[model samples]
Target: MPSLRNYDLFISHAWKYNEEYYALENLLSSADMFKYRNYSVPIHDPVIDPNTKVGQEKLADLIEAQIRPVQCVLVIAGMYAAHRFWIDKEVAIAQSYNKPIIGVIPKGQLRVPESVKFAAHEMVRWNTDSIISAIRSRAL
Candidate 1:
């Protein structure tokens, strides 16, 4: 890919909790986000195929292909995020690639999952302004 205008954020979250998912979508799509995000959901959530070995192989290939495009990873620290397999997998991949990881705590919640605290390079609230401000603070 050509040099990106801003960072590409690979989002990892637990399927059990979707509030943070929508929260992130709003944050990244905002005009104020400064083209500082190219947010993508985890590979397992997208383009999954169980029809045949060939189809599965293709999806695996696609996932492998996408790994390079991720510059940063946002991990949504939901209640069950720490125990989810796919969430863990995504975090591991981000860590291996040395991507900047930001863990967001969804609204109406303050307690953080241990995984988020440990895996994230930084952590923030899910509110749009707070999230944006955290990004700005981290940049500085």
Candidate 2:
């Protein structure tokens, strides 16, 4: 088989770590022949405080920087309801840069937010094969 391409990706979340986020990370890392570079801001290493207007702008800039070079943006659909603001900003950033957005519905999740549903270029399941396929076919 040919060597797999290494994709640059941005996984959107509420500026915090969650099970879905970690699961996807592990999945991608362990998948056979799949490789990726995650640009998502880790919870343990924050870029800025987002309490004030200036801070928010800085945060936005930081997020943009993370998204600018990415080929695709992976969104945790189940986390949208709770982190709509950040996720929306991430989506907007991804759109501005023409990065493909792939919404991953968490395992066993019943309902997904419309915000994510509408923004995603493609919605995928919380599985290694599905997510890898999306990145391979959809990522710019």
Best by TM-score: 2
Q: List the residue pairs that clash in candidate 1.
A: none
Candidate 1 backbone clash number:
0
Q: How many backbone clashes does candidate 2 have?
A: 0
Model 2 Cα shift for residue 118 (angstroms) = 0.4
Error of 2 at 36 (Å): 0.8
What are the per-residue Cα lDDT tens digits for candidate 1 across 44-92?
Answer: 4444553577765674454445554766677788878867765676777
Per-residue lDDT over 1-140 for candidate 2, one digit per residue giving the tens place of the 0 to 100 score: 77778899998877454767888888889998888999986574454667778878988888999999999999989855455687788898899888999999998898889888998999998888899999999988
lDDT of 1 at 111: 87
Q: lDDT of candidate 1 vs native? A: 0.66
